[model samples]
Target chain A: MKPSTVPASTPSLRQSSGRYLQTKWKGLIIAVPYLWLVLFFLIPFFIVIKISLAESIIASPPFSSLLNWTEDGALQLSLLFDNYAYLWEDELYYKTYLNSIKVAFICTLICLFIGYPMAYGIVRATPTQRNILLILVILPFWTSFLLRVYAWMGILADQGTLNNLLIWFGLIDEPIRMLYTPFAVYLGIIYSYLPFMILPLYANIEKLDMNLLEAAAALGAKPLITFLTVTLPMTLPGIIAGSLLVFIPATGEYVIPDLLGGGNSFMIGKLLYSEFNNNHDWPVAAAVAVALLILLVLPMMLYQNVQARQVGVKT
Target chain B: MIHKRSRWVIAMLCFGLAFLYVPIFLLILYSFNHSKLVPIWGGFSTRWYTVLFESPEVWEAVMLSLRIALINATFATLLGTLAALAMVRFGRFKGRTLFSGMISAPLVMPEVITGLSLLLLFITLADIIGWPGARGFTTITIAHITFSMAYVAVIIQSRLIGMDQSIEEAAQDLGAKPLRVLWDITLPILAPGMLAGWLLAFTLSLDDLVIASFVTGPGSNTLPILIFSRIKLGLKPDINALATLIILTVSIGVLLAAWLMWRQEKQRMQDRKMASRTDH
Candidate 1:
């Protein structure tokens, strides 16, 4: 549960050219990861910004050159706000984004609902029991995620397991349509991301330091009162972190919405795919991507602030 | 004694497990169904598995996915290990937090966004440089490596942060150069963490479908993509058979790991007991 040993390098380093060496090495250590970010993450984002300003093209890969202003004062390039206008005017992209966010939000709530009790139950169980429960939670993850989603499709289709069961039990006259519905999308998203929610909640709950709740109860607090006063506040950080992990990814999830929700899932991931692969509208896709970046910007900045605060570091 | 409320809690947990596992279990069970209808109970048969193996296209997609996963795992491990080492070994720089944040961003960013962004990059790159002529295996593998490396780095960095810095300092004091200190002191300590990170990255890449679908081009489909397209049309029982095989593999792997850890824990306890006896 805790690290058993601590390395003694600090004292020795402090004895020798310490501050200078530490400063230099720390700077160096941070650079390798920094460069990767600049190249793969940041640069790609900047490029998307640049391309979003351009006109759509029909090529193997779709992008156009930057529109530089003329030296004499008149604008030289054919750059315009067509893509942004299109996103506003066209009903589909905005609808997709809205739907994706809606699904992610609702799924996050269900995951929290299901996961909280399970997490609490495990933490209250014996350590052996907790370990077994945790494994059971993670075991499904070890299988191929796509294949598992595929399995869900087989189970949820009109003629699938639920329908078959209904007929066999004589509960229904005809099979109910399930697959390709928004309900199916919700099912897929919740099922897939539930583990992401549970693991963090479980980690925080298991380390809840039961003595606090026990002391509160001994002082005459009810079980519900103690949980509200003691347990809930302590696990706020983990809850936030877990939701970010689940909701962010679920927003942009492709396969689940694509398969279970079918073509009409109206998720942004499928829409982005359409712009690039089907619609051949690169500029529009890039612009939608810019919208995505803006959407992610606020929460991501919040996450950064939290990370900096974790080590008591100022940023 | 278990409380009344606790039983309800456990029952709730059991329902969650059913929600998670029943669909997959059903997938496995129905793999043996002799009929094409997924849920209809037919006489048990292994024909689907045989048919799955016989399909060359499926095999090729599986093989391609394997190759991509192996390559991605290798690159991710290397970059992640070095980045992790740097994060710990190097002193905190002006933008240390920023760097860490950037590297770890992929872990939380939606694979959809990551894929979308990367695909846009590939297209933009092609327009600018005319290299990587087409977005296919190479591009997809590169994309996987980029994200997987971040995960590996995070895991390895956590391990390095836990490690005692004194061991590496001791090596340095004993006439070892910086590189030699790293090679001897740091690497041995980091090996287990890196290996664990590598396996984790491998599994993640193998499990990816959303991102792969975004970045993958025509005629270069990965197994997950292939399976997904088929499932979209409708799930075949053979898909069930495939899921069963994968489940078996992971179950066996986890069981073996648990056994090994148990043995090591027992040995560690015994070793401590002997050491205490010697002191006495």
Candidate 2:
């Protein structure tokens, strides 16, 4: 009886245990990151929404709670729309939003013009040269981004290197006022974010099949026409990816505007920071964030969709 | 392979690279200037470096940033690796779309939004759970990990996709358990990608100013925050010295990484040649 029971139970026990362990391992893998993100990344948006609806108060937390228990034991919800209403009524907010979009768009276009050719050059280089070039492209990126932006301040200042060189060349009698101006802000954004544009474009352009171009050329299509028809269409995803990478963050760029734009350039990011830090208006800041998120959701979704497609293609 | 347009492309490349590097080289050049004024060139001196070294606040900020970066990198790499595995290896799990979206969203999310939301979460958690009672190191680290891990996940996920699955399958076919196969074959192969992800996370955490500013409490200034506040008033020579040091360290690290990757690729090519030779 003992021998018979052992023989039957052993196989079943092992099989069951193996299946159980597999499921448990898989569950743990999914659960840990999932729960962490849901807790920290996702739930906080809801909180922002809640706080955006609540009134700003002079308290430790600094915002009134959305929920309150009434004296009659009824659950009462209080959500003030004043923060949003205030944003809508104010001309400054809409103008800032539009200005931010315009800056981001123009910067993205400039980055594309600069980055595309660089990416093309890298892709056309010999393998050894390509590696070095790619590394060079990424090297500045590894350095502190803020420091890179700060580096521009040294170059673009009134008495900075560029101005000094110009004056010495007798090109100008006085130092050009480049820093703390809209020009400085544009220069900084392009300088800092050009790498972002180049990388994706490089990745896309590198994958381009040379045979297609050859075929197009062989068919009597001129080089420029072939490029427009074959190359550009194929690398549109990269263009979109790089453009979004630059545009989304550039729109909300706080550092560049604060440091270089001075009092002239008003980006949504700086406005949000001043609201939260300078005015201590949590509700207003949250409202600003929500509005910014609403504006950005489309591009963000487009980016995610492109990434997913790329992954899908790979798999 | 050369085209008539190659000349134009090459010129563009030169111009673009110059644009990127010229400002940085100028900053490095000016860091040694004796003048207190940033733009003026007094005779060269290393006084700024000495001043930077002597500043206790700078030291403290550096130490804190390093600590936060270290912790953030480790935890981020772990969680990110797990997320990558779950996404790439675990086939079509529940809420996979949502999971993928959450993983990628942080990559492009505005820092202000991410920072504000995370701070709000920490506050709510503190109110409800009474943990993380004050926002400082822990809150900053948590915020860094949340975003940095998204980056790590992208890196590791690409690694996972590019990896050869047959090796792991072979290990399983040879009677190795799944966990054992992962530990022995998968993780070793993935070490380089993991290292890259870790470094990226570390750099991101160290470089963050905006998010850290939002989450950081009193007496918790990271290096970027301190540097930012100083630079906000005006450019200081000491800060330039600090920037120069950061640039130097990053260049060295990047060069080392590139060299190692090159060597590894060479080794892989030689191994493949040998394998084909043996097969012949």
Candidate 3:
């Protein structure tokens, strides 16, 4: 009966219809998101590139159109290279870019040193303690970022909590001027982005094979040697992931530099904001955005590659 | 060596936790200070809270933010779910790499760049299409949706990847249509993830200051924009009050989520135990 049923059922007819329905459903599902991204996310970048090449005009929208009609009914393209040239010629922009990179690099290093120990501790903790500890780590992240920066302002102000505490301890004769310095900027960045470093490292460290460390120890390796030779190399991906997570965002950080670093610190984010808002130079702002994107493209691609590879390994 | 390293790890952990939390506690404490100056400790009072409540602009901004967040969450979740399905279920479609790149790029993109590029896009669109008349509620909501959906897609994609597919395959084997199987079996399983994605999208939209700042026109200030503009001059007691309130709300929400997850884990354990006992 089963053998007779197979031929009677017409398997090709069922399969073809099912496949046809699936193709339609698949197309619809893919098209909606793909088109939305193209229209909003992808195409806007091209517009930025176009505007960066156009002259800044004193009009609504604030940039000259890229294309114009000539007298003889010919389309003319008017592109200005001055914006990029201006960014090149201005030493301020160059210095600001360098300074931002330096700040981000230093902060990333600090975060790694601080966050690694914490992540290792969490991984070694009991299950119940691990959950609670992780929640504590992530709690600040759930709150408002701006408010956290504001909290630091109160702490680091001239007459603020930290200064008052120090004076009570007789550690200082006068209230130290700490707010709005590069010091404040570094502290603010490290405080806010510490979680980004810790979470990735924790995930990576948690997945480490304990047997490898055991084997290293059995081979007459000391605890420190086992850690250095086995644990550290195993968590290299995590270290890279965490560093990139902190460094990439820190390079273009606007809020921390603006609120904490004040006028003393000049990051690319602040430069772009001022160029667009205060100076109203749309073309220059677009140029700054383009330059920032170019600088970030390498790291961004690295991060994406790491993430894709991780997902691939998992699947 | 292990024993010594454990002590150091504990100390580091304590220090890191304190660093993360002390500022928040201090900020909460200062909200009650009566003095206008933020650092000074006057007698504790609710004056700042009263001031925050009295400001009409603050009310307007809060209302506008809630509206955008609500609209943005719904649309972002819808689009994000579709994208996740396309990514995980569809498998190896045309332009798949570009699609995935767009989905993940926004997670790490700088706010200033995103804001500037999106505002330019809007201006160009207004000139060419003239549909979105002005850059206000609609524009800000769209901008929020674009980035927020990226986050939602990541959340749902992970959930989709971890899901057991045998149940879905079994449903299809029992003469269920593809869409029928999706509606009846797949979506119910994905409901929790979708809810999480929605809440995250809402929070992101509500918290955004930079992107909203770029796209906002006259008479369309969001809560973050209002808070930012006010605090840019100096720290305000009323904003401290606002911050305390935000922190309280977020804490309660996070704690509730954590508790729920804990309870769910315990229940799973007990069920497993019961099943084992019965089998014995």
The global C-alpha lDDT for each of the candidates, from Candidate 1 onward, is 0.78, 0.90, 0.89
- On TM-score, the stronger of 1 and 3 is 3
Instruction: Give candidate 1 misplaced runs (Cα > 4 Å).
Output: A1-34, A58-64, A68-79, A304-315, B94-98, B273-280
Give TM per candidate: 0.90, 0.95, 0.95
Worst 10 residues of 2 chain B by lDDT: B161-170
Candidate whose DockQ is highest: 3
Ranking by DockQ: 3, 2, 1
- Model 2 alpha-carbon drift over 4 Å, by segment: A1-22, B1-3
Clashes of 3: 0
List-wise, what DockQ does each model earn? 0.55, 0.56, 0.61
User: Residue B62's C-alpha lDDT in candidate 1?
Assistant: 85
Per-model TM-score (chain A alone): 0.85, 0.91, 0.91
Q: How far does residue A243 in candidate 1 sit from its true spot (Å)?
A: 1.4
- Native-to-model Cα distance after best TM-score fit, residue B141 in candidate 1, in Å: 1.7
